[model samples]
Target chain A: MKPWWIVVRKEVLESLRDRRTLLSALVMAPLFGPLMFSFSMQTMLKRGLDEQDKPLQVAVMGKEHAPNLVHWLESQGLEDVPAPKDVASIPAAVRDAKPRLVLVIGPDYGKRFRAAKAAGVKVYVDSSDQDSQRDFRRLDQLLQNYSSQTSALRLAARGVDPGIAQPVMLDEIDVSTPASRAQSLLAILSYFLLFSTLIGGMYVAIDATAGERERGSLEPLVSLPVSREALVAGKFVATMAFSGVSLVLTLASFAISLRFVPLESIGMSANLGPKVLTGVFLSLLPFVPLAAALLTLVASFARSFREAQSWMTGALLVPTLPIMVAAMTGMKPTALLMAVPSLSQHFLIARLLRDEAVPLTDGLLSAGGSLLLTGVLLVFVVRLWRREKLLG
Target chain B: MIHVTGLAKRFGTVEAVRDVSFTAPDGRITGLLGPNGAGKSTTLRLLYGALTPDRGEARVDGLLAGPEHTEARRQLGVLPHGAGLYPHLTARENIRYFGELHGMSGATLEKRIDELVAMLELGEAANRKTQGFSQGQKVKVGIARALVHSPRNLILDEPTNGLDVMAIRSLREVLRGLRAAGHCILFSSHVMQEVAALCDDVVIIAGGRVIASGTPEQLREQAGTTTLEDAFVKLLGSETAEVQS
Candidate 1:
């Protein structure tokens, strides 16, 4: 075997036997993302389904003044509950979320209806309250339907066509498929994958560099006939192996866990079947070297194992920045954007999950960009390893 | 044989090694004796190619000893100060790792590891991880690892710093066995008795400069002292007194 390969094999064997490395690389990093993702996604899907299936209840004042309106609301699935005795406390009650929402029909509502004038109704709701806002939307839609129905009746009684009231009706056609609709939520999946990739190689990188130095084995190791470049290459390859394994395990876990989430109930689906999973893994394959090199480079600067661990923890946040920016700006993958490492992988992953074909140029740019940056970082790491101060 | 000629090193404003030169010939043990901070480690580091000297060169078997010279390093085995083993690796595995790195593998590497285990009397501990090994066992493993490659020259920097009495005795026996096999052994120490007992030739350094060089008896005669320890103290005392004046 070559010198670098020998070094790589030793490092891999040593790290594999280490319990801390195994726990982080095999267990914690791979499971944390999928478990948290699936649990939260299931909760979100359940809440959405419940909101649509559950009845909307509202407290009503002056129900007698607008008995017809109340009747229309009940037909539209709004349950009418008795209002509080004091009308002045309605805002406080809404703010306190006692009834969640309150609807008040003014005393003049009946007179206005008889006079064919517009009757005013007040909806008391705290807009800042998320659940109250959802209930308020259902109640508002019911009220609007009642008003339109009454207007149509008035128009028909006057021997005029009620159709004239609605001009230029919007016929909305949804063009998004379930997979495409799910892309927004699954955009976070790329971040998790990238994060776990960095985490997978973290301890290995620190162990090979800072941990070796701290243990005082580095002096003997470096004093061997092997070149510093070979030693560093070996360490980098071992780290990449760990990160790659972690990336694949995380992808598989996500694929299996997403099945239990009721994405279909929310008009979305996770396209994480075998084919998509393989595609995502391939798309993210080039990122392993980049993450390994990045972690190794940062760890080589640390003087001790504890210092390297803290620095690696900070390095874990690097992949998230690009993903966060892409999500916030709604950035689409262009030729230039594809040349950015983590961002390109995010865009490719989102595309793969949406069952869209990744452009060949985009794929090449992403892999090439990540590998080129890896080369640059490897140069820095090798140089750092060659320095006499590396023994520290 | 190992030869170092006029080596000088500077760490920022501190001249860790102002000037150093020494040679340890084959079939003999040479001790680089000095007080702490006397540049013994720095000199060994330069000789082992871990550091570059500012004004001199270290040569092993006629080849320049530096980071760029892999062939020179191939002929040298170095046991550095406070050497540590990988806690997750067994004693045999630790020895085999260095042997493999030196381009030895297969049955040869395994045989060498077995030999080291028996020579050091590692026994069952050779198959177990080094994490909870005693300090003596750890040092034996370190020495075994350094010798696995069977280099012509060996360098040890403060190898007996933390060893107990028995460990030190066993370590001395190991060095004596290597010397009998015609290997050039160079080691550094601040202990006067250790040098007087083990070294065939002694080079005394104080303030990064070689103050005296001879056998223990010769050094005692040169310092006009009855004992080697008294000679060492007198030589260092005069060096400090000269600096003060």
Candidate 2:
């Protein structure tokens, strides 16, 4: 076998025995993203389904004054509970309420209704509370519906057309497909995937360069007849192997975990079945080499294992920056955007999740761009390895 | 044979190895004896091509030795000062790694490893992880790794730095066996007793320069001293005096 292959084999064998390497590459890094994703998705889905299915409950004061309004609210899925005795404490009562909401009817409400005059009511709620806002909005809609009904009846009684109240209806039409709508949530999946890819090879990259030097084995290894290029190439390939395995495992975990999340209830389905998983893995495959090369290059400059580890933490953020930017700006992918490595992969992943056809040129550009950078980084790493100061 | 001529290397302004030259012939043991910070390790590094010389050349078996000369390196086995083994790897695996890197594999490599284990008396340690190995055991594994390819020449920089008396004795025996096998052996040390006990030729260096070179008996005779230690001190003292003057 060639010298580079030997180095690769040795590195792989050594790293496999190391518990830290195996934990990060196989267990921790790959599982972290998928598990967190599934848990959060389940929580959001549960919250959404609960909001729609459960009836809104409100503490209503002066129930007798607006009995008709109370009946209408009950018909509109608002349950009335007994209100506080003192009207002065309504704010504190709302704050103490389960859903933190209270409805109060004025003493003149019935008189005003009988006289066909404007009536008054109050809804006390804490806008600062996030969980109560949904209920508040539902209660507000019910009151608006009751007011419109009363107005329409008055108009009909006067022989005026009630349809004049709504001259122009604003019917909202959401054109986003279910898959495309899911893209917003699934954008995070790309970030996790890219993050796992870098983390997978992190220990091995550090171990191969800084760790070896610290262990004092580097001097003997470099003193051998083997070329520095072969050694570096071997280490790089080993790091890529770990990163690739991590990517595949992360994809598989996401595919499996996403099944338990009720995305359908939220009108957002994750396209992470076997086929999409395979496609995503392929789209991300090109990034493994780049991740490995980038990590190894950064680690090569580090003087010790601890220093390498600290630098690598910063390096892990390099590929994620483009993804974060793309997600924030909701950047649309153009042909030219494919030339940016991590951002291009993000676009491809987004397209795949949306079930949109990925252009062959975009795929080529993304893979080409990543591999080109890998090549450049590998050259720089090899040159760094050849320097005499590298022994330090 | 290993030959070094006018080797000079400096780290910024400090000349770590200044005008130094010596030769280690085949079938003989040559010790580069020096005091602490006396350019011993730097000289060995230059010889092994880990560092290039600023003003000279190192030749291993008639081939110029530098990072570019793989052929010359192929002829040498080096055990750098304080060299370490992969703690996660067993002693045998560590030796096999170097053997394979030297392009040796299959039965030939395994058999050589077996011989080394027996020769070094590594015993069960050969198959055990080196993480908790004693200092002596680590040194043994390091030497075995260097000797895995069985190169014609060997260079060890302070191989006995942290070894116990027994470990040092065994290490000396290993070097003597290599010399008997017609291998050119060159090692550096700050200990005069070690060189006097093992070396056939001594190259004494002080402050990055070779102050004297001869057989232990000849060095003592030249310095008019009864013991090799006194000769070393006398020569080093004279060199220091001359520098001060």
lDDT of 1: 0.91
Candidate 2: Cα lDDT at B107: 100
True contacts kept of each: 0.79, 0.85
For model 2, the stretches where C-alpha displacement exceeds 4 angstroms are: A57-75, A79-129, A139-168
Query: Residue A2's C-alpha lDDT in candidate 2?
Result: 96
Q: Candidate 1 chain B TM?
A: 0.98
Residue B94, candidate 2: C-alpha displacement in angstroms: 1.2
Local error of candidate 1 at A217, Å?
1.0
lDDT of 2 by residue, B84-138 (tens): 7999999999999999989899999999999999999999989999999998899
- List clashing residue pairs in candidate 2: none
lDDT by residue for model 1 (A36-66), tens: 9999989988988888988898998889898
DockQ for the candidates, in order: 0.77, 0.79
What is the per-residue lDDT of model 1 for residues B1-245, given as tens digits with 9 covering 90 to 100?
99988889998898989878888899999999999999999998888888878888889988898877888889999989987799999999899989989999999899988998999889999999999988889888988998998899999998888899998999999999999999999999999889988999999998888888988999999999999999999999998999899
Query: Which residues of candidate 1, in runs, are more than 4 Å off?
Result: A61-67, A80-96, A104-124, A147-168
